[model samples]
Target: MSGFVLNERLEAESRLVCILGLCQLRLMNDSRWPWLLLVPRRAEAEEIYHLTPLDQTLLTFEAGETARALKRVTGCRKINVGALGNVVAQLHVHVIARNPGDAGWPGPVWGLGKAQPYDTNSADALIRAVVKEL
Candidate 1:
């Protein structure tokens, strides 16, 4: 893969965090969840199978690392990781830290309600925390 570009929807919805071994880590805009997206820098990779075997391993490693970092940073009781491409065809993994009684608790976060945008200071703090852990 080459000349990789982020999906328009992702670009609009996320803030760039940093680059991982096989992915570009991005922070989701929603304040309701401590969400991060791991988007592989592989052009046209709308699914995991599209990546090379070695790249696949790297993605998994990166996702696991991101998930752990999220958990540590947020101190959430649970961590949710998924790659559902129904709305956005681009292949990206979601690493979210969840706690009981959260807005979307005991259910999927998608479409449960509106996403509350983070305040400037909160967003910066979260981004910095995740980056430091990573």
Candidate 2:
């Protein structure tokens, strides 16, 4: 897409880790969970079906790869992958590493608790590690 600007809400919430074949790999600012977001660079794509056929498939591939990378980095027992655009309405996939005793526990991360913003040093280190994995 030519003018594929990131949604403002997402831009305000996350930092760019890298770009993938069909999505922009971003690190969610919250430190409580090792979370990543994959946003497809398609203009006005509010849903997965809004993307081109190739883009839809590419999004799945990129999201899965991101999840594996996140799991390796966090060593989490479970991975939560989803695309619930109820609020931001952007076509972004959430690749979150979950453990048994996390803040959200068995519930979804969204709206469970306040986000703990990552420290600058921690953010940089994680970004470097994730980029290397990608």
Candidate 3:
């Protein structure tokens, strides 16, 4: 399949880490939770159903693995996993660790506040930690 472009708005808003197999794994700019974004490398994929069955399976497995890694790293009580493209229109899944007293605690992380940008060193460290397991 021909590769489609990930929009600049999405890329600019997310803290992309390293590639995890078939997806370009990213950390959400929000520091509220240990949030992640998993985007397949396929182009023009505005919906998950647009992917081939093989790719769909790969994305699911990869998202789960990433979620587990995030849970382990954060020791979070809960993990919220979802794929919603209402705003950016990219086929990306969100894997977020939830805690009782987090910034968006007792509510969804979307539209509650601004994203906390990570420092280069911190972002690099997180990427290193996650990539080590992949």
For model 3 the local lDDT of residue 78 reads 91
lDDT of each: 0.91, 0.90, 0.81
lDDT of 1 by residue, 25-52 (tens): 9999999999999999998898899899
Candidate 1 displacement at residue 69 in angstroms? 0.5
Candidate 2: residue pairs that collide: none
Clashes (backbone N, CA, C under 3 Å), per candidate, total 0, 0, 3
Which residue ranges in model 2 land beyond 4 Å of their true spot? none
Candidate 1 lDDT at 39 equals: 97
Give the distance in Å from residue 78's predicted Cα in candidate 2 to where it truly belongs.
0.7
TM-scores for the candidates: 0.96, 0.96, 0.90
Local lDDT at 24 for model 2: 90
Q: How accurate is candidate 3 locally (lDDT)?
A: 0.81
**Which residue runs does candidate 3 get wrong by more than 4 Å?**
none
Model 1 stretches astray by more than 4 angstroms? none
Worst 10 residues of 3 by lDDT: 1-10
Candidate 3 local lDDT, 1-134, one digit each (tens): 36567778778878678776678888777666778889899988878899889999999899889988888877889988887888888788888889998986878887776778877787777777776766
Better structure of 1 and 3 per lDDT? 1
